[model samples]
Structure formats: C-alpha cells, structure tokens
Target: MDGKKKNLTTSWGAPVGDNQNSMTAGARGPVLIQDVHLLEKLAHFNRERVPERVVHAKGAGAHGYFEVTNDLTQYTKADFLSEVGKTTPMFIRFSTVAGELGSADTVRDPRGFAVKFYTEEGNYDLVGNNTPVFFIRDAIKFPDFIHTQKRHPKTHLKNPNAVWDFWSLSPESLHQVTILMSDRGIPATFRHMHGFGSHTFKWVNEDGDAVWVKYHFKTEQGVKNLTEEVATKIAGENPDYHTEDLFNAIGNGDHPEWTLYVQIMPIEHAETYRFDPFDVTKVWSQKDYPLIELGKMVLNKNPENYFAEVEQATFSPGSFVPGIEASPDKMLQGRLFAYSDAHRYRVGANHNALPINRPRNEANTYQRDGQMRFDGNSGDSVYYEPNSQSGPTESHQNKQTGFPVSGVAENIPYDHNDHYTQPGDLYRLMSDDERERLVNNVVGAMKPVESDEIKLRQIKHFYKADPDYGERVAKGLSLPVPQNV
Candidate 1:
C-alpha cells in the first residue's frame, strides 16, 4: 500500500495549524477578526446557500416590548436595562434549525430564539436557541456538524448514520443531544418553551467592572412539550402549526410572555469556575449563580406581512449596545462574525437598512454603497470616520471593558473536560416519567442509525451521563449495554 498523507490547507493552499479552534487572543479568547481562516470558512459556509438562510430558513416573528422590572445599573450600563420600568421596542424570531423554508414546524430539532432590541444606542440582538446548551463549543466544526444534520450528499435525504456518527465521535455534543431527544425537544407551541442566550457574555457597569453572564428567558406561559407520536401526527397534518398558533394567539390578544433572567458570575470567578464558563455545551448552575430577574418580554403583535417583516428580518449576536459585550467563548466568538456575514450574504450588504432590522438610532458608519443603498449614501458627507469634513467622529462611549489577555496563542481546548457530570446531573433532576420518555425518544431516533458501532459509541455517551439512562436506551434499541464506559 502506498501511504501518502497530506497536511490540511486553507483555500489558498497554506497549511493550517489549527482547524478545530479559531485563533484567539489566548486559549480562552475573544476571537480575533484577523483569523482569516475562521472568516474565510464562515464566509464560505454562509454563502453555500443563497437568498434563504442556510439554517433557520423556516421561521416566524413578532413585535414586542421589553419592560425592565429590576434595576441592573450596578451590573451593566446598557441603557435599556439601566433603569427600572424602562421599556424598549423589540422584535423576536423563532425558527427550527436544520429545516428548509418549507419544513414542518414540529420537527425534533433545536429552535432558534433571536431577539432584536432597538435601543437608543443601536440595535442589540440576542441570538440564541430554546435550549440553554449547544451540541458543540467550537465554531470551526459548525459547518460540518450542520452538514451531518442536513441531507446526505448522494441520497439528498436525511442520513441517520451521519447524524449519529458525528454526535458519537464528538462527545461535546452529549449535553445538547440529550436535550434534543428529551421531552422538551418538540415544544408544544412557540409560547411554551424557554429560551437561552446559551453563550456566556460580558456585562460592564458604569465603573467599567465586568462580569461573565448567561441569559435565560423563562417562559411565563409555562414549558410544555409534545410527545413524539403527537408531534409526528401534527407534522403530517399541518406543517405550519406553530406559525398559525403564534399569529392567532397574538391576534386574539392572548399575548405570550417570558421573564428575562440572568446568572451573573464575577469576572474573576470565570478562571476559577469548575467548568469553562464560556463553553456553550455546558450551563452555569443556578446553585452557583442564581437566576436574577431582569425584565419581561411580551409579544403581543403579529407581523403584518410575513415576507417583508418576518422573512426579511435579520439578527446577529455581535449587535451590542455598550455595557453588554462578547466573552471568550469560542463558539460565541465565531458566531459574532458568522451571523453578520450570513445576513450580509443571504440578505445583501444593505439588508440592515430594512425597517425590520434598522436600528432606532440608525447607523452612522462610513461604509457605503452596495445593492439597495436607499439612504442616499450619507448625502454629501465625507465617507471616512476621521474626515476633515466632519462626516462622523468616533464615539468612544461604547467601548468594551475588556479584560487583559494571557497565555500564548494556541489551539488549547476548553478548561473543562468532564462533560458528563452536567448531563448526568440534569438526568437525575428529571422525574421517573420524564426519564422514561427521554429514553424512548432517544432510542427511537437512534433506531434509524444502521451502524452498530455508531449506536454503541453513542450509548457509551449515555452511559457516561447516567448508567440507568444508558442501559434503558440500549435495551430499547435491543443492543447489549456497553461495559466500562
């Protein structure tokens, strides 16, 4: 056998040193924009599909207001949350991940929960998912992970083998894969599930003191989920069931709401925290950092035009409004660029000019002239920030209270490696009935995976989470329990 291995290279043929993790200031990083490998990879991934989004293509949106109930001026200087009783206009979009524009609403998939708050400073988008944890923590593997979830290359159909194989090999996916196969996987309606920012972010007070924070939007309507049989039946009966429910509920004045809560950890606590605070695959326990009530978001108005308001709407987690800043979370750092790049490619460069995305304060950037530059390209103003013509001057008011960087730049993995403890803890918290349903649901999905090796490998992950959880899934799949996991 002739053995000739090759180094992995970028598009221009430069050999890559680290493809799994993006280049950062340090191992735990606020990802540098200079990571052209990341930018190029994400840019290419975003452009793979045109017009419609590559993921989250099927979605529904509504108008709402966020009413701050608790004073968080001590935690953050973000104007919207600075004063109690302050209200800000906002919009929210809900979508199913890995689904096409015409896919069913009741699929067993993660739901996108993106909110755009049009604050006085600018638009701040909290782009997240219904689940508080994610499948993977690194963004470089995102495109590949999504590929596994999408149609097979040769068959053009969903491949269970690829899905299970990828999830098995990547043990980091255990937390999210567990939740995705549990009762909460198929939410009863858009109003019934909780939403989470999922990534740890930074919050700065007036004193410029920063803290690591996680956001939770607890559903006021209560968390309700549909069983697999019911969800399957509904998917067959009405693919737009969720869309209709949201629109009708809002129209009939049955407004649904969620109380915004956050778990705030002091900045210094991050380095000493048991798990990687920035890892999107794990959650900061309420015990360590209790949920602090912040505000309430009430969605009472349905979109007037689906295509104009909902379809044309865009969001990016990088859209920040001072005091609120990005953390060193690798997945989040990748998303800060990926989401915006995706919007630019899928909805054009000037897509933000649309009413749905246009900020209340509007933008004052010198960057101009693409398709649909309808705002007169700044109208005779100088096209540079530091121009003598006084086009626009830099406002240092919104600077991040950035932390100091340490350690050499390398592809170091996250601080925590024990992924099973959290998932196991979550399993133990569930009731007996919930545990049974979780097992049955996970087993049902794994049944389509033909490879015994893949099946066993995944069972090992379950075993690692909880022995009972593992054995039940194994028995349901009619496979012998994995030993010595």
Candidate 2:
C-alpha cells in the first residue's frame, strides 16, 4: 500500500479523511452543515446538467484540419483561403436538428454541418445544415417553426398534424418540405451527405469589394441515403448508430473528409436578381453560379471527453473573421443573437472561455467578468473602451464595404413567393422510384392528421407544384382526388 500521499481535499483545499461517509450525528441523524464537501458535491451534482439546445441537440463532433486546395484571395480576403496548402485546425459538429439529445440518430430530419476554423484572425463558425434550403426564411417564425417539429407537449409524442398545419400555412416551407420527404431526408451516414451554409453571407475583400457567398461542403465519400424501411429498422436496432459510426470510424484511422466549395454572387447581380438574395427558403441555381473550389476538411481526431469537447462547444453565425460578414438574411440575422444567447443561458456567461469554444487566436474584447471566469479576469486589464495605452482598438484596415439601405424600418416578409418553381424542378429531376418514395413518405406522414381541411389545403399546395404529386398523396391517403376543382 503506497499510502504516502493518500488524502483528499475540499474545493477550499482543506484536507479531509472521511469522504466516504458524511459527517452526521449518531450515524443516523441528518448530515451536519459543517460537511462542506458533502454539501458542495450534492449542490453541484444537482446542477450538473445544463439546458439542452432547443434544436440540433443530438450530435457528434471531431477535431480536424482544413487545408486550402485552391487560392480564392481575388474573391474574398478571408485568411483561411488566402494560400493554397495552408492547413488550419478546425472542430466540426454534425447534428440532427429535430431530435432531442437522447433521440435516435436515424430520424428523418436535417443534419447540422457546423464547423469552427481556428485561424489566426479568430474563430469563424460556419453554421450550416445537410440541406441547401431551410423551411422558414424569416427569423421571427423560427421559434414557431421549431415548435411544430418537436413533440406535442400534451401527448409527449410527435404530431404530424401540428407539423403539416404549420407547414401548410407557411407556403415558403414547401421547398424544404419536398426535400425532407425525399430520399435525402434520412442520410445513410454523416460521411455520405453534403453540408450547406444555407444562408447567403457577405464576403468583402481587402479592396473593399463585397460579394454574397454560400458555403458547400461536398462529402468526398459521396452522397448516400437510406430508404424509410431501412432507416426505421436501424433506428430501433441502434438508436446511436450515427454517433457510434463517427467515433469508431475516426478511432479506427478511417477519417471522413469533405471538399469545401463556395458559390459567389456579385453585389451588382444581387440587386437585379429575380428572387431576394436573402431568402433562405429558396436556393440559388447552381447553373447560374458555379461552385468554386476553396479547400478540403478532414476529421482526424475524436475528443477524449465527450461532454467537455462536444457538449460544451458553441457555434454562432455571428462569429466572423475580418473578410466574412453577416448578410441581411432575416434568419441569419436572428441567429446572430439567438445562438450566443442560448449558449450563455445554458453554459453561463463565459461559455466562450471553454476550451472548445475559445479561439486559438488571442481575444482582446472589452467583455470581462462573468460566471466561470476561468482565465483569471484577463490579468487585470481595462474592461472599458477608449483607453490610450494600447488597450485593443477597432480596425479600419479590416473594414467591409457597406451597401446603402433605405425604407421604413418595420417587420416585413420578403416579397418573393415563387416557391413552386424550385420544388417542381426538384420533383421533375427525381427518378420515378424516388418520386414514388417521396410521395409515400409525405402521405405516410400526412395520413394521421385529425383535420381533413389541413390535409386538403396541403394537398392543394402539392397539386400546384405537380398534379402527379398531389394525386399520388391523395390516393395514398384515400382522399378524394381533385379533378381540377
């Protein structure tokens, strides 16, 4: 027994011997208040779990490197893309948006493909999803839309009526709904799917030229998805299948990789474009703006501690480097505030100070002193602005060219409503079998709806997209087919 240094201490560093038993009276009475160790452990244990994220709660992450494959310094001044073959360390998190933290990994929902590049400039988080377009375009409807996707509070079960009722009312969601009902809705694995920065972001150059851009992470493994039948079987057999697959794949030296691509829209073209550039519900035509290869990402390392590295990590769209800036996309604009706010609420005010979220580059912000100030209050520096003695100041060299904005500042929806064109094009492009499955998926979900009116109205929207689509779903549901009604 090498008991030379066998002792334990409380948080205050006082050595204690009887940690196995609480200090109590007569070995049967309530524990003494002087048992600070017991008190501390119990209190901390009670608050061990923080609030789970409202969406994208079920996920996995890995450490990796993003190496530039091609130089695109002419388009944007983001340092990560400045030089070819330059490798920057990054952390990526892949998640299912609709499921709770303990939910099955094979659920039919969009997977979040978010990455944080730890570059010299700072941490730049590209918050994206596996799908190119989202259900809602405006940030104001985000909470409401998310509520419909979640389980019904009273029944504690998934409600298709709640889902379709909201989706049917909001026509902008039609495009995404089509994709969700298709084969891509349930990805075969995290490696076999594409990730998209669905919102258009403004990228500025050193010369102050601005262009709108969307990020695409095309999986080098190729896109593969499971049929509904297979997905259901896998879900019941292994609810944590995806998470286990990702961890074991990385651990077994088989790294998953993705190629980074960007589609840029010139500032001039955005003004004259047929649809609003900021509408997230619709995607820009790939034929018009081709993808420009930028880099490659490879996840090579799994975290030693899941909760510390993965669960504690926070990614916000607002976190941008010098050349990258937020656009006027309403959903993106709302996420700028909502993400950080949620993190703070869940992980305390200094959530960024966590090792996972902290930037590798030095941060000299005026923000200081909150809960979990692990970095020792920045060693007694000035927390206020306008200091004379080399306290970090704003940069004019990294200024972004701002476009002029005019109009009454009020809540307004985007003027464009051409939702059918894209969905129709998508429906037409699908193979016959794929289309049949999509219709079956839609009807299978829609059939259990208690309200006939919602079903009819939604079928009408589908009918507007393509008569075949509407008729197929109608037939599956045994609803009267609309013969040009």
Candidate 3:
C-alpha cells in the first residue's frame, strides 16, 4: 500500500477489513447480518438519488460573476449593483422547462434561466425563463398547464392532444404558444438565447422611492436557433447537445456573457397602464418603458461536482436582498412559497445549509436543527428573539415600505382582460418569412391533435390575433376558415 494513501472506512470511521466480499457463516453460505459495512453500503446505495424536480429537471449550470456596467443606484439599493464596476459572485442554471431528467435538451420548450447572486447582503435568486411572457397569467392554472406539457399518465407518452386542448381552452396562452411553435423554441445553444425575469419586480432606492421593473438578459453571443427539422435531428442524435455546448464553451475559455437590462415603470404608472402591469402573460412594450442597461453577467467557471453544485443548487424568487421586493404578480406570489417548500421537501429542511445554496455572508436565524444541521446547530446561540442574550435583531431601516390595500378578497377571474391584442400585435410585427414559419410550425404541431374541435378552437384564437395568421394556419391544416371568426 502507498504510505500516503488513507484507508477506506465506513461512514462511522471504522476501518473496513474487506470490501470485496460480504461476511458469511461459510463459503456460499447464508450472509451474516452482523456485517455492518455491507449493511451501510447497501443502505446508502439504495438511497443515492434525491427526488427529481417536478419541472426543469434537466439543466446545466456554471459559476461566474456579475459586474455592474452602468450606475443604477438611483433605481435600486441592491448592494451588488451599488456602483458601476462592482462585481458579485453568482451561479446560473439553464434548463428545459418541461423535460424529464433524460429528455432531449433541444426539444421545443421554454428554457428556465435562473440566477443566484451571492451578494454582500444575501443570496438574491432571480428565477426566470427564456421568454418574457408565459402561457398563463395566474398561478392557479400552473399545475394544470404543466400537466398538458408532460407525458400522459395512462399512456406514458407525449400527448399532443392534451397540449392543444389546454391551449385552445386557455386563450391567454396564444402569445407564448405562438412563440413556442416558432424557430426560437429550440435555441441553437444556451449561449445564444435571451432570458427574462417574466414577472414584474419592485426596486426600492436608498431614499425609499420605488419603481416597478422587469429584467432582460440579452445574450452577447447573438441570438441563434435551430430550425425545427435540425432540432429534431439533433434531439435524436445527441439529446445532451445544449448541456455539452455550455460545458465545452466555458471549458475552452469561450465564456458566455449577457447584458442585463431593466424596464423601469414608475409606481404610479402601473395603475393606469393599458394592460395589467403585473400580468406575467403580458409584456411591457419597449416603446413605453425602454430598456435601461444595468450590468453584465458572464459564466466563466464550470461546477467542480455536478451533483453537489449543479443538481443540489436551488433558487427562489423569495430570496430577495435589501432593495428588491416581490410584486403583486400572482404567479410570483405563489412561487415565493412554492419554490422554498419544494426545496425543503426534495432536498431537506436544512436545504439552505448545502454549500451551493449557502449564502456568502453570515446568516443569522432563530430557527434551529431539523435534519443535517452541520454548523454546530448555531453554536448554542439564542434561538429566540427578545432574549436576555445579545441575539441577532432585525433592522427597521431594512423594513419594506407599506402600501395601501383595499379590496374584497375573492376568487376573481381576469375575464375582462383583452388577451388577443398583444398576441395579434406580435403576429403582425413578425417578418413575412417569420410569419410563414410561425404558421407552418403551428400547423405541424396542431396536426397531431386528434380532436378537430380543439384544432379549430385554437385556430380561431390565431384568427383573432391576425386574419392572415389564422388564414395561413387554416390553409396549412386544410381546414375551412370560419366566416365569423
């Protein structure tokens, strides 16, 4: 044995006598239950995997830093963006939203673009997606909408019928559905696509003045996408294409970077906006609120261990810093609790204790151990506030400003919303070639649906958006265009 080598031992630190063979009464006889090493090894092996995420299971992550490119101290008090040239360490996870752990990376799906910034104050997670608008506006429909995107329970296969059925019924999905069926659905590589913090967020300045904001991360690599045929071919040939592309690019020192921009809307303007400002399904027009250049985010390092870092790293929009706070976006509100709850259930009660999820700055809490309490259980620090001991206390300066609220809380549907306007506007804005591709893609996807009613219903939504858009899809599907529609 090499003198420098350490002996292998059980988890309890007992040296193993023999690992190749299990203890037994005699050769080929009944195995002895007293073999603690064998029991320990088998038990651990049986529990090797944690439960996979319900969504965005397949993904790639990298470590990097975010550097402020422009001064935005007047807009937000977030310390990481306190001044131009200030840099903060961060981790980013790019993922396919609807795919399983083993699914193809190039599939036509919205990609999740979540970033966790290890700021001076705390970890601020900006959880978002590749698209600025989502399929549905409210969180209540989220589970049902996601169900349609996944494999059927009984058939255990991709169900186009379910997808189209859901989209046809949920007219608000038209904008996102149109984008999904377009060339941009399958990004050529993670580095070539844009990312958006879909929900409206609040940014408070040092003077306590606040504004509504939306975040956009424009890729420095230039937007590129795979055609439908090419994406399908690549999906068959190499399912891990996107994951490998990101890993190799960073490995070769060709780090991917994105310019961060924010669309700032004054607090008063939100109440009188043409559309619901807080709606995740709608986007703030660039004309009204132009993009303000904020900073740059570059992924420069790969994770040392995939499972320990990438797989275990969790993010929550609730992880806000001093200047940032949640908006009234219904989906964002639900996710504030849902994300942290999912992490607790899947990872552990002490999921925050994981090295990757742990904050860079010191963390103080009245909470104590549940499981995997690794930090000496806070070293006998007082676990309750208002104690005689000098325990951690909250700062009034950091408290969020309160706003007036007067509403009869009830299950209110946004039935009064004009969902077709933006989607129609979007269709008309596309180039001739883009519109043709969009029509062809929609027709191709809708063709697999078994129900003609669902197809026609969805086509009607297209027609409502743009006459030409509906007419083209109707022609492609070889269906008659409804006179009234």
Candidate 4:
C-alpha cells in the first residue's frame, strides 16, 4: 500500500543475502553450521505453537467500550460504574466450550463469554458462559465432567456411553443438559446470543456494604439460534461461521451491542433462600430478585492480529478489581485458581505482560523474575514489601470485608441442597411445543448409550422433573415407562 519496497532482515535487523538457499558443503552436501539464518528460521518455526487451552480453545475476540447507562455506585464502588455515562475500554472473547482450536463454531456446546475491562484500578475479568446455569456446582467434579465431553482416550472419538453415564449419575447436570439439547444450543452467531456471568459475585460499595449479584448481558441485536439440522449443515460447510460473522459485522461498521443487567440480592437473603445462592447449577427467580440496568457494551473494533490479540489474550476470574470480589460458589472458587494456573502454563509465567492482557494502569507488585519477564523486571525496584526501601505498600481501603463462617473443616455436602425444584419449574414453564422439542433432543442424544441401566436412571430423573417429560422421552427411546415412576 505504501508503494515502496523494503528489504527483508533477520530478527536482529541483519540483512540476508539469500533465503531460498542455505549454506552447504559443495552446494549439494549436508548443510553447514555456518548458516545462522537457517538455524534461526528453523528454531523459531519449531516453537511457533503454544499449548492449546484445556477448554474454550476456539474463539473470536474484539475491542470495545462499556458505557454505564445508570449510576450503580449505591451497589458497587467500582469506578467504571461509579457514575452515569462513564465509559471503560474493554475486550471480549466469545468461544465454544469443549472444543479444540479447530472445532466447528456451530456445534451443540455452551458458548464462553469472557470480558476484560481495562480499568484504572486494574484488569477485571468476568469469565462466564452463555447459559445461566452449569452442569455441576462443585469444582471437584469439573475434571470428570470435562473428560466425558472430550474424546475418549482409548477410542479417540466422542463417546456417547461416557457422556450419558456421567449425566445419568449426576442429577445436577439435568438443568444444563436440557438447555443444551434444546434449539438454543447452537447459536446463530456470537452477536445474536445473550451472555451471562453464570456465577454469583459480590459487589462491595464504598460503605463496605456487600450484595450478591448475577450479571446478564442481553443482546441488543436480539436472540437468534440455529436448529439442529441447520447447525449440522453449517458445521460441515463453514466451521468458522461465527468467527467470520463477527469480524465482518464489525468491519462493515455494524457494531453489535449488549445491555448489561445485574440481579442483586441482599447479603442477608442467602441464609433463607429456597435454593443455594452460590450454586452454579441453579438460577435465582427473576420475580423475587429483578434485574437492575447497569450499562451497554459495544464491540466496534476488530483486532489487527488474531494471534496476538485473541489467541494469546488470557483472562481469569481471579483478576478482580477493588469493588468486585468472589462469592462462595464452589465452582467459581475453584476457577479463581484453576484458570490462572492454566494460563500460566499454557501461555507463560509473565502472560500478564502481553499487550492484549495488560492493564491500562501501571501494575505494582513485588513479583520478580520468571519466564519472559518483559517489563524490565520492574526497573530494579525493591522486590519485597515492608522493607526499609522505597517500594509499594498495601492499601487498607482495599481490604476484603470479612464474613462469619461456622463449619468443621471436612468434605461434606451442602446441608440444605435441593437439585430438583428449579429444573422442575423450568420444565413446567415451557410450552407444549418446547417441551416436545426438548424431549426429542434428549432422546436423540441419549439413544447411543450402550447401558440400559444408565438410560433408565436418566429417564427417572426426567420423570422426577415432570411426568410428561419422562413419558415423551421414554416413547422416543422405545423404552417402556416404569410403573413405579
């Protein structure tokens, strides 16, 4: 575009004589060690790939800004939402969970909706999914749950027996399984679906008052999804359909936006709530706790480099600012450590120093040398705090508010946990047609299971949720409905 030709140079700016041919003995013998250019090129090529993510590996990202539409300082002391019309630059990555880097975008899997806000205090990451509920509430079950979703080790193929066996045994998975089998499982595009902070979080105001909140990013473009038939066809035709759609939309200046809403519950309500407030597999009734308008997020810029800005960009639920904090959700609590540890291993120890992952404000920490310590290693400053040297100190104002706890340190299940009511209610609320479609989807997904016991066990759970639901699925699977059920 500049209409000028430039010479090629090595990484260190040294000019090259000829790249097509390497230095060799007698021009036809083995290559010579004197070929520094050949060695550099081969070495760099060998290390080109970083390790892929354990989950949500296939993704698309964009640059954007979040503008507060209403003042929420009464609930959260976060500066980005301190006043009306305040805009904070942000980045978002929309991904498919349980997929590798080359998976199809239209697969029947939960979509990941993670956001990183470049705030004055620090980088605040909200890692979530499109659905409001998940398969399991406890993090200890995560590895096993994911193993079922992935290819079997022996067969190297998707195993329906493994999937149905796990889901049948874990009744808590029914809620998410039902949703995934429905039409909403395959979103039409990244811009056409809703995003959610599925885990409950804590918002602390300046007065140290904390409230439990759940975030919902309702799509302004409206919800659109692909049917099972269409999604399958598109997957074969264009595996990168969602990624291409997002890029084209932003490039054509038709930016997509989502309105941010939060369901806030008083901290006192946790004790008496019908369902566990911190459970990842449950949802709060909107009638009891309504959504409060927060702001709007608009993605208007596409990344110049997909590898640098999207693939290498890392986020973790642990990256919290001052006003926002973690809840007692077991799954979320595990992610606070798991996500960052995975990033450190997949990327590098200094992954935060990457431009795409860096915070807007200067990072002040006593952390010293690690792999890829790029920020000049903090310019030789004192690496430890509470020393006799001039270094950064802790802020008393940013201390987390303490909550009382009374429990023995042992592996125990939640005392008042009930995994059925909410999912039952969900089934009852669906229309006759929706219920039929759901039953059909479930039957189709479960038909491949080799175990009759697993099938009957899962059908029983469906029956417990709703008799009609169980009966329909039983008919579809050609299995007789149990008289006891």
What order do you get sorting by lDDT, best first? 3, 1, 4, 2
> Which of the two candidates, 3 or 4, achieves a greater lDDT against the reference?
3
lDDT of 4: 0.92
Model 3 global lDDT (CA atoms, 0 to 1): 0.92
Report the error of model 1 at residue 229, Å.
0.4
The digit string of per-residue lDDT tens for model 4 on 129-207 reads 9999999988999999999999999989999999999998898988898889876788999999999999999999999
- Score every model by TM-score: 0.89, 0.96, 0.98, 0.98
* Tens digit of per-residue lDDT, candidate 1, span 129-228: 9999999999999999999989998999999999999999999999998899889899999999999999999999888888889999999999999999
Candidate 4 wrong stretches, greater than 4 Å = 1-3
Better model by TM-score: candidate 1 vs candidate 4? 4
Clashes of 1: 0
Whole-model lDDT per candidate: 0.92, 0.91, 0.92, 0.92
After superposing candidate 3 on the true structure, give the runs of residues whose Cα lies further than 4 Å from its correct spot. Answer: 1-3
Greater TM-score among 2 and 4 belongs to: 4
In candidate 1, which residue pairs clash?
A: none
lDDT, candidate 2, 1-485, per-residue tens? 87797568877788877878989887696778988889998998998778888899999999999999998888789888789999999999999998899999998999999899999999999999999999999889998999998889999898988999998899889999999999999999998999999999998887888889999999999899999899999999999989999999999999999999999999889788888889998888889899999999999999999899989999999999989999989999999999999999988899988999988888888888888898988787877889876899989897666779999989777888987878888999999999999999998899889998999888888888888888888889888777664
Residue-by-residue lDDT tens digits, candidate 3, 374-427: 878888688898998999899999998777788789997764477789989888
Q: In model 1, which regions exceed 4 Å deviation?
A: 1-50
